[model samples]
Target: MSGTLEEIAGSDHAALARWVEAAERPAIVRGIAADWPAVAAARAGDEAIAAYLSARDNGNPLTVLVGPPETGGRYFYTDDMRGVNFRSEKMPMAALVERLLALRGAADAPSLYAGSTPTPESVASFATENPLPVDTGVDPRIWVGNASRIAPHYDMAANIAVVVAGRRRFTLFPPAQIANLYVGPVERTIAGQPTSMVDPDHPDHARYPLYAEAERHKLVADLAPGDAIYMPPMWWHHVRSDGALNVLVNYWFGQRQDRFPFAALMLAMHSIRELPDSERGAWRTWFDHYVFGDGAVHAVDHLPPHAQGVLGPPSPQRDRMVIDYVVGFCRSGGSG
Candidate 1:
């Protein structure tokens, strides 16, 4: 794949600028230029190498990315990951091999991997081993596999993903940047992880007119090892592993003081949106007076109140509750 930050010129830049402003999406810088060494070291060993090979051969949906030639050309395509089951299972070499062989010639069995990250199996195991925290964070975990494609999805909150081995391609659009990006049907059971109906090259404009708008604001990044990508809340991104053994550790972060816009939206949804329409008027007034305020009245002025009562106390209980709710929402198919 092309190296990170493939900036388009002239009209492309103008179109991108409009899209960025319209969508308020996050920014991305490619060729971080510093994360390569660690990425190389991590993939150099036998155990790690074996883990990757096993995932690849068994149809586990993981992928790997090697560096570009110093002279520079597209990175090599290390594997094909179109159909591996990343959502349901990840197992030993033998089991994966068995499953792949069983499906061979039986039907349209595309010998590749495709599915969500933190598959159902992984989530279930995580929930039991380490209860998700409320208003806080989950226990840190590292995910390594091959050819897995995290379909078009938006993550709640903020996240930083570090590439340990291999390369990845990420296509991102802002949450508010909705015109050209097709949002998937929201599941009643799960929430937060919204699906994007975007397919970079040939997007369906008739069905999803907004996607055309989202497309105008598109940004693409091809990532390499040691490289970490930060996805701000509400931004939509579709990830495809561009290498053989792609190992990544994701850090899901909490809302920070600076991320008040997201926090305000979250707060408004939980507090005011729950109120009856007539009653909600008062909250809007408050929001206008406090959040969008007179030239000088900013959101921080209202934070003290939230810190005291409106949002309840700042403790692990609330954090855990939020985590559990979100996790459950995902498990139940919020992004289905």
Candidate 2:
């Protein structure tokens, strides 16, 4: 109710780039993949889509996630959160299609989800025919399945997902809702990332009362063939594909970075969280000044660019020094 996904024309590359650079919210690029051969073929029928992909299949066995209908087409953790509900196995493209066709009309059919698989690997010419005008040389990945759903999860990289066949609904939330989403164990993550334990379709308010707060910050997008959605880095999103056959082609580009942010965060966690409450409060002030203040006193006006090193203009030696320090830290059992 509060936020909505704004739609923009797919041909507007300039607008797309602007949105990609500063998309404080999700945006929809309608008919972005309309010219894609696979998407066009899908318009004929599911068999057409299957045939096209099958013809292009390079005979490589790929990972396919399988789950029973009792899990309601969702690939997630068990009730006790010990392990994932679904299991995956390697299967060739043609065999996977045959199995999906056999179970197509069955009411009690098990779910089959082939996730974030490479488009070019499955169909060697896919990237050439369906190229997106985003960053150069960034190939697309395909997610094909039969009426399956993936739980809400955040990706570390920025994402643009194009629907090729069938329809998809994305229930999205901002990263700030991480606390309200009731996330499960990180180490036990099933779907490449730590996904929300609470099912958005049938959320148990009694068990997850905070989810209502997250919902207040939610935005939704329904994608048709050729439609695409742009999601910024670390934005939480839940995706559900409808109908018999669904295929989503997505591209992920790493966020721009020039320094060792992850290493610094790890160092901070190692040193900061164990401090006493009073000392921890002091650390917050210190972080606000040093880390969050865009390298404040240590930058620009006070120090020359050469002296500023990693905090100011880029320095190759400083970068190498930081990398070497991290490598040494790792090799020496994290000792100072």
Candidate 3:
């Protein structure tokens, strides 16, 4: 909603690595996978692409999300938010392709989506034939579906996704806009990650007025076959796939934490959120000095390095100590 996303060229491994390292926002790389066999097959036609995928099917049945035509291909929560709008069904790649082809021209076709199927197991030779340009040491996952709108959500790891078929529009928001995005329940999620309650496409401003602030910082990228988009860690993105059949392969990498940040946030909420206002203010100051502040690393400088212990620089021993302490404290009912 703010402006068009930035575009960069080149698809070599080094160039891609550099672009990812330097990017603080989403960037579109046009024709990044132009030479891929999947892209060529897609350009030929839907049937050709479907056949290309069927030829590589390894007989593994992928879990597909099926929703009625009333949902308009949007996989989301029900009106009461107590249940999901879609049901999960398992079908082989060839069978799934047939179902999609059959519903190609139907105006009220049910949504059929097979998301995040491991490329190696689901489509045996696809990864080998169409390799990702970067070397993230992570295997790619494939998403095949009809027109669908995924709610805005953030991933724990950085991502690079390439479009193999159809068209995709990515609407991205910065991590700082989390407060304005009206995030939904963390424990109850349609997917593994918590998504924004407000729909970016058709926002209900009356119910979620703060979402208007998030729109000011939005960035959008419309990608065609062979185009790719790079997203940094924890960046909220809403994805919409257009056409009767769409396919995308994405790699997620660079997650280095043993415990997720959200887990820590939950713990903090349990311990500190309901405290008295004065006590909460005191805790905020302590947190600023010891955690979020730029000068936190030097806060322990007054003490000798040998005496710093857990407050010292990061190391395997310190990490082990912290993990053990936290585990012991939790197991002992916080008595430690």
Candidate 4:
């Protein structure tokens, strides 16, 4: 087993708390299982599973599960399901299923949502369920796979992921651990499979000496079908499949979209307000040096301007705040 894995599986929440306090980063809580039945329901059918497998087999955009009708409700299988609740633009499952089957039948046929081409039904059906007590606009993504892999990347919103069919290995390190993680170019990352800076084992200790000291605060939970993991904001995690088939659903929540413009303004104004052009470029270099590296996954906001690391390291308060921020974001839905 890897040294990082050893630290993760053996450690308790108290140890995690200590790391959080010292590092001012995200923490992981293991073995919290919920809503397995619904996850299985989506993954049950051969057609659905085949469709998903075909998507991945051919390098297509995987299916996404939008929000449910109720708060924390079971995830709806189709994108159009949200149309009934909110005025969403979406491609109905019936049509989407046809698209999937069509692609399977005729490999020459173009894939759905392929390019700049507009999806009129999907665009028209974009909507969200509102008037709920909790912020519930953000649609979550659910996937079922037989030996599938997700490339490393940081999401703009906080994520709560649940495993339903099999096991998975999550290699996580705090954002501060970026220097140690050998990262790749950002342009390559946007396409998918963003990676680390340093080699996990044979790191170039001379170039990134500080990376040696980066604590790999990791946790490897052999999540049974129902278990879930909550990856807090700004945290970096890479996942690998460990079972015959791994089924997972992830919820990403953040404050309203309206606030993002404000957040971006705040970030731009505060971080680089006074730097000259040369210095500004230097700042980007600084960011590229410390936060993003060759093949590494990272958050742009977590860099200098938007916010510094978690206020006081990882504390109960900071954890709560991160959760609130994510859920809040979800409440603010988008047009599609």
Candidate 5:
């Protein structure tokens, strides 16, 4: 019972807020966004959901990916790992809706997908119709397409993905399985983010035997319309859309720059990883004391506000200082 995500009834804003702050694992929030107009319209029919979105469409162009049937609707790197198998185009939300609606019955139509399209960019009033308990700072995005597959990836921000039409299946993995997951190139990516190289639907164990190790850490969730999942930041998730037409609305928040992982990672990579084995060992001790093993997550009672630059409390000024220090280091060859 302690290991599994709690299933709470309804979208209690107070309860959801607490979960966003303290819940350490993924949660299956049943009926959280069920009352959203878009979800309700979707319950009526596929056309209803499409029409609901189109009515509020802002006419913004979102990036859409088109993949041939040979790829089996899976967007991934080419067989040679040199490039992706999909072509991308900037399409208007309303037109994309029409295209998806038209392809509902086409068995051989190329996979058409538009993911991470901002709600404000696609449909300005979409969030008003589908309210979330999260802060306004959280950016809500729309995903629409016929049946398609999204490769496994982790986001920098915490995510709450709500299913509007059709069904979605998610396979999740914790960050601890990064090594076993066989991540793809950081430079060449299918989308803007790095994705797992191993295919979960068809794992070639011989080529990537460690991927089987990742399987043990996998958590599966099958969501219907009105269902949403609370995914903590850095949790890897693989999503697959089912049925003829599918739509998902997701919100991403918790994008705190003060928490400071990326900047620290870049500095360490430039300065530490290339060091001699013995020198690298010394840096690990310093990292433990100052970075990863820091007890800052719990409390700042040990230090006064004045003593804490970035650790005591969060502030925009403190955030700027952290960034400036990192940037200055990079510009000055890390000495000044």
Candidate 6:
């Protein structure tokens, strides 16, 4: 059943890290960044926060997506799904903030969003001034916008998102709800990841009947300026940013897979999806035994260690061999 997210206090960094690592579901951390300068600035007013960020601007132009008011701040595909509804503009962080502030009270202001901009590149001192409690190897990225809705999409790695300014609402669904979400095209997507066609805010139940099933498993979280949320890998989430100006800082970690799973899925679809039912079923069994199933560890135990190759174990040598084989196969036009 759908429910509100569990709340946790981010007082202890070690405890917070442990909890985040073991969490199977998403959790909202209350006032985790209350002491941050950005949050303080946001509390003062939208103009204060804008000035704070602009002061740290590195002068690099960030690509901002601009969507007309007709889309109602929801950036997505056009009617025919041939192209996106938003046009991208490269502008400095200060300029973008000024534009958003100017249209603050407008009833039909165009959606302006600058997503996944590297904090160090755009705002030179942002990372240093507002450091995350725990280290996430990769640098944090900033998402700045004004009153926008992003479709439900899953990330490949685990994420910790902190709301530095304004407010955010996250509607989350577990990975198992994939089938019911009515996912769009994988290759041609609004963003890099394939997003759900059904809008969580206003689901078209008639066109998407199965979304009702997905709605049953939904979990919602409303985050304020200093609040934070932790999401595990592949948890589908639809995000809505409220207020005239919003800023979110997020860190993505635990993405060191040998090969991207989505790329493997695309390759399998090309090679195996159109096969005969019997053949496909047999391949499924093989995949289960060697990939998804627990018995994969011992699947090649019967063979000599020297001859086991990629099936034997996860070692540097085996990983290199697998990579070489894949590269060779692709280079040979998949003849092998």
Pitting candidate 2 against candidate 5, the one with the higher lDDT is 2
Best lDDT among the predictions, by candidate number: 6
TM-score of 4: 0.44
Q: Tell me the alpha-carbon RMSD of every candidate.
A: 12.4, 2.3, 1.4, 15.2, 3.2, 1.2
Taking all chains together, each candidate's TM-score versus the true structure is 0.51, 0.91, 0.96, 0.44, 0.89, 0.97
True-vs-predicted CA distance for residue 335, candidate 2, Å: 5.5
The digit string of per-residue lDDT tens for model 2 on 1-336 reads 546789989999889999888857789999888888888988988898888888888988889999988988988878787778888889878778778777889989989988888876777788887788777346789888899888999987789999999999999999999999998876567867788988888899999999999989899898999999999888999998996888888888865566445457667788788999999999898777766776655545687666765555446877777677777887889785
Cα lDDT, all candidates = 0.48, 0.84, 0.90, 0.44, 0.82, 0.92
Per-residue error for 156 in candidate 5, Å, reads 1.3
Residue range 1-336, candidate 1, lDDT tens digits: 212343322223344344333434444433332334434455574345344434434233433221222301122122352322222334544344344444434434333332234523332232233232122254433454444455467766666555566687788776666545555544321124545555554566776666665666667777666455656767777777644334555656654643335454665576577888889988778767644667423444546654533233446765665566656866887662
- Name the runs in model 2 displaced over 4 angstroms: 1-3, 256-267, 294-301, 304-312, 329-335
Summarize candidate 6's per-residue lDDT along 148-216 as a digit string, tens digits: 999999998999999998899999999999999999999999988999999999999999999999999
RMSD of 3: 1.4
User: On a 0 to 100 scale, what is the lDDT of residue 49 in model 5?
Assistant: 81
- In candidate 1, stretches whose alpha carbon ends up further than 4 angstroms from where it belongs are 1-38, 41-48, 51-87, 90-140, 188-192, 256-283, 290-336
Give the distance in Å from residue 46's predicted Cα in candidate 2 to where it truly belongs: 0.7
> Best TM-score goes to which candidate?
6
**Any runs in candidate 3 off by more than 4 Å, and if so which?**
12-15
Pairs that collide, model 5: none
The C-alpha local distance difference test score for the whole of candidate 2 amounts to 0.84
